[model samples]
Target chain A: MTVQDVYLLSPEISLVGLALLVMAMDLFVKRKAVLFLMAVVGLALPVALSVMLWMDVQAEPGGRLVGVYGALTVDKFALFFKFLVLGSAALLLAASLDYAKRLTRLQGEFVGLILLSATGMTLLAAATELISIYVSLELTALPLIAMCAFLGSSRSGEAGLKFLILSGLSSALLLYGMTLVYGFTGSTYLTEIGEAMKNPLDPSVPFGGLVILVGVVLMVAGFGFKISSVPFQMWVPDVYQGAPTPVVAFLSVASKAAGFAVLLRVFYVAFPSLEMDWALLFAVLAAISMTFGNLVAMVQTNVKRLLGYSSIAHAGYLMVGLAAVASRIPNGGETSALGSLLFYLGAYTVTNLAAFFAIIGIANKIGGHKIDDFAGMAKRSPLLAAGLTVALVSLIGIPPTGLFIGKIFLFSAAVESDLAWLAVVGVVNSVVSAYYYLKVARLMYMAEPASDEETPASSISLRLALIVSALAVVAVGVAPRILTWATDAAASPLLP
Target chain B: MDLEKFLILSAVLFCIGIYGVLARRNAITVFMSLELMFTAVTLAAVAMSRYVASRQVLANPGDASEAVLQTLLTGQVFALFIIVVAAAEIALGLGIVIAFYRSRETVDISQANLMSR
Candidate 1:
């Protein structure tokens, strides 16, 4: 590979270097806090590298840099996700520092695993080849599996084992589908695959068009597990109930972001011509994920498990955007659909982090993660309770929150795409979701305080992480122009 | 040596692997089934590389650019990658299973149902 190709991968490489450095420092440092501070500060390297790369790509003629034998594409879209993953990573580390102390003996491995997974996610955003995508996906998952089970409890071990087996199965299925696609199209490059699929093939031939169809469906099924959509979402609740809160936050946000990034890239780049077909498929899945997620989430007692199901509902909403984007295939509606998807991703990322950050602090103090355990939370810890209230309201897509505006944009896009029925389903599901989301908030505010003892002061870093993320959630909702502008620009390449 | 036959065999193996993963109670057996699925994928890729891709290259010999030929043979490279990744996954899976066994003293996944509620 040329120097420029390596340049394209500089952000991921630097991040991996930081992870290694953090892990190495774990061996030498007397104060474990140094590793945390160093890991947080070391992120500056990757951040700078990505911003520089973004500028270089912007200055290029096409505003894109295809490098490393066309396996990676550096552009606004990839840069957008890179920023999302990296920024959330910094916040995740900051927010979870005290919580990570639980893994006292393995603190180094803990932070190192997070950074390593973040590297995979950043790489995922830029991957444009089938092989690169698969490699990056595994790289993202492997660390997470270790982190999931790193707690060494029976529940933690179960989470790790389930995650490992299910994730491996999904990857193998993905590989098998990739083989089928490769066999059908005779290429591994997204652009080339798209070019090959431009023409409708004869269904009469032996493997014919059916091969590509099967390949696409199987690939979607594999990724469905990553995104935690229906039929593939069985593992989420169980895993979330058992895994550490910080890892769950990272998994629910950055990992899902990367999954959607690749899904969008692959579908938009390779299967644009078949949008109507895949779009209908996504629309159906969106409906199922939203409905089932909300309905089942209503029954969950564990806060993490409830959030798990809620995240599934959110996946459905985002897919509504993806499916609606397909409806624009004929008219090529500007960036309304994909733009909403991107904006909602940014919104969901910040808001979920805020909620989970607060949970990490409060749950650490509460000694349990049950919904009932949150009773009198507001009386005990006003700051954390306030943060949770704002986050839960935002999750329900309430007014003056990022998700409210995001839902508006998404529904309008669905309407624009002539998928008004999907929009209707989305609106109905939002109302249904509000019932459960508010249940948690109401419990915190109204339920009797469980013996109002002196409230323990949470670490400053956790509060900062929670406050910043919560404020960003409200800030974006109140004045969404910046996020909208950023997301619109980020979504531009796919629309064009 | 027909590509179709190879594809059918891989597909059958993949189905069997999925079934085993779903039906097996032992985590190790489930993991082995997952490995079988990866093996099926490997076979599919190699067979595709041999029967589909090489045939395409040979059918249009003079027009093939070196870069283009490499892309055509990407299936083989993909197979190589799958093997390596699958191995890494197996190592990690076994480690996770060992962790699971240590906690509950059994590899039975059904017994690892602490959060099944």
Candidate 2:
């Protein structure tokens, strides 16, 4: 690797250094909250470096800088996800001050592991080669495994163990798929794999593309686990219900974002030759995932587990956009499906973070996450109740919300690509989803408080994070021009 | 022999690993099954590396460039990385399993159901 490569990797490298610095600082610092503060502040360096790289990509000829002999690509696509991951990490850390402080003995380690995981996410968004992708993906997951069980409770232990085994199984599945791809193509570089797949290898079984078909399917199943789509979503609610609230927030948003980032990159870069079949595959999976997630979520009493199912449903909605890609704007000259996907990811991140922070704040005082516990929250704590209400509204895709606009673009793209039935499924799912999302809002506003005592106000950090994210939801809803431009630019490197 | 033989063996081993994961009750045993899946992939990678390298060298006997050599070694390098990642996964998996055992006194997958309700 050259100096150029290292320069391109400054955001990831500096983030790793910051993670290590947080752990090392634990040795000298007595105040653990300071470590959390330091972690949030340390993120500025990576954010600045990524912004510089974004400018660099904009000026470059192909809107990308292929570094480390093409194992890593510094493009607007990678930079956009990097910024999102970093932004989520900062907000999560800042907001989790109360929840994280409860881990008195392991606070430093808690913050440290989060930083390391964020570093993995940043690298994951940029990794272009299969081997790099594999290594970076592990880096992204291992810390999360530890974090899932970081509380050391019985349920947390169960969550961690289940996550560990399932994660190992999924990676093994993905690796075997990669092995087949490598064997058939004689290369692991994506462009070369795409070239090799132009004429598939064996013509004996599975419609003359047996090897690539099995490979692609296995890889999809593996990534399906990461993105928490249906049939592979069993671990999500369990882990979400058991893991620390902060970590769950990270898993639901940043981890899912990274998973989609890699999925988009791999499909766009490596499998350009295969067409329409996987689109149908994703569309079918999308339908089942949303239907199943919404159905099961309706019965969940635990707020964490309920939102976990909601995340699965959102994953399905996003897949509608993923499957809507039939060509490069064949009809009207409008936004690409991928741009819509990225925009949805950005909107979902802030919206979910707002809701998770509200829960974290309320749960800190109540010590339980039951939907029943949030009854009369509007009177108990007006700020948190309002924040959560806004989030739930956006999640249901109501007007004047970011998800409303996101769903419009995604469904339109689906209709444009001859997948109007899928768009209908998405709309019907969204309407069905409103039943559960609005349930919480109604409970908070209508139900009587269980006690005369008011829950004390949220910590200053939590309050700030909650308010900022809630406003961000409306910002994206109202003036999405800048976000749309960024998403369009991010999508260009992958499209014609 | 051709590359197909090795691929078939790897596929069988992988299927066995999947069976073990589904059938095993103990968490550690399930984790062991996961290790088997990784091992099968490792074997597939190494086998493919050998077969593909020989095929490429035969196809162009003396035209060896750095990029061509790197492409030929992708399989072997991938195998190496898989082994390393599997080791790390096992280390963390065992750590969590031990953590599980401390609380529940057993690593049976079925019994760990505090969150089911």
Candidate 3:
């Protein structure tokens, strides 16, 4: 490969290198501050790399190279996700430093794995070939499985094991489907499959589109598990409950966004013709995931599990955008709906992350993660309470919140696609979501504190992350033009 | 000895693997069942590759084409990929099992409910 080809993949290369550097420093260094410094630098470097790569992608039209012979991709869609993934990692790292020192000692490895997983997620968005996507997806999953168990003695281990087995099963199913698709198309390159599928009416092709459709369904199911959509989301609550708050937050926002990013790319580029099949599937998955998640979340006493169900509900809402992209809009046309969906994903990620940051800070202070533990939080810590309220209100799709705008865009997309019933179901679920979010808010504001012993103090770094995320949530909510532009730029798949 | 027979065998194996994964109680055994499913996919992929290659050879006799060789190679490469992934899965899968075993003193998933509400 040429030097330029190598340069195109530098963001991923740098992340791998940075992960190793942190690990090596962990081995040699004994000082906590040194390790903390390494992690902060490690986290900051990716953001710099992402910005450089984004500029590279924008400056050089068609600069992306299909290195390793059509497997890896270096494209605008990849760059967009790389930026978001890296940004999320940075936020998690910033908050995690304090949590790590207080809760656990393996700060170096924990931060390193999060960065590595972020790298894997970036590749998942960029992968143009099936095998590359499969490997990268595993790369993403393995770290998360390990991270879930990193708490040493918590239920995180059990949750991690369950996640591993179920996710592995999904991977096997996905691989079989991919192999079947390769058999039918004679090539694993998505564009080649698109071309092969163009002559959908050709009878000479051995298995009718039925087999290929099955493959697509399996692939979508695999992705659905990652995004915590219905029928594939049984693992979410357990995993979230077991994992540390920061890791849970990472999984809910960044990992979920990465899954959606790939889903958008695969359907929009590789299987646009098969939209008639998958659109209906997504529509149902969307409705079930959102409604069930919201309803189940209403009764959750554990804050982590409640957020887990809320994550699932948000996944359902995101799928509305996916359905809109996959379905044909009446008067608004096709790609326009897709652009809106992308915008919504970006907005949703920021808002979700903001909510989780507040939770993590609260959990750290109170020495508990239960919803009941949050009673009289507004009186105890007004700043955190205010931040969390913003997050919860945003999550409930209240006006003047990012999630409200995201829901608006998603519903409009669905309506434009003549999916009024789907949009209506989504709205109902939004109402359902409001109850759980308000439950937490009510505990903080209305309920009297049990005792002075129940109250907890917050840390400075954790406070900073909460404030930053809260500001981001409001900023994105109030002025969505920035996200809209970024999402619009990323709507078109970076084809090789 | 034709490719179709191999594919049929793989399909049957795949079904059996699924049954084992669903029915088995031991975490290790369930993980092994998952490996069986992966191997079945490898068998199907190789068989399909052979079918495609032989068809190409018969249609263009005496060519011994590089393109056909690459087509077969894709199957072999993917098979290798599956094998590597299965190994990694086993490594992680067993690690968690060992960790859980240390705490619960049981390999059966039913007894490992210390975390479950």
Taking every candidate in turn, the Cα RMSD to the unseen true structure, in Å, is 1.5, 1.9, 2.4
Model 2: per-residue Cα lDDT at residue A318: 88
Per-residue lDDT, model 3, residue A310, is 88
Question: What TM-score does each prediction get for chain A alone?
Answer: 0.98, 0.97, 0.94
- TM-score of structure candidate 3: 0.94
Give each model's whole-structure lDDT. 0.89, 0.88, 0.78
- Fraction of true contacts retained by every candidate, in order, equals 0.83, 0.79, 0.43
> TM-scores across all candidates?
0.98, 0.97, 0.94
Can you rank all candidates by lDDT, best first? 1, 2, 3
DockQ for candidate 2, C-alpha atoms: 0.70
Q: Write the per-residue lDDT of candidate 3 for residues A254-293, one digit (tens) a residue.
A: 8988888777777666776654556677898899989889
Candidates 1 and 2: which is better by DockQ? 1
Candidate 1 backbone overlaps, count: 0
Please provide, for model 2 over B1-117, each residue's C-alpha lDDT reduced to its tens digit, 9 standing for 90 to 100.
Answer: 767888888899999999998889988788788888999999999988987687678778897888668767778888989999999999998999898999999989898889966
TM-score of 1: 0.98
Q: Compute DockQ for each candidate against the true complex.
A: 0.83, 0.70, 0.56
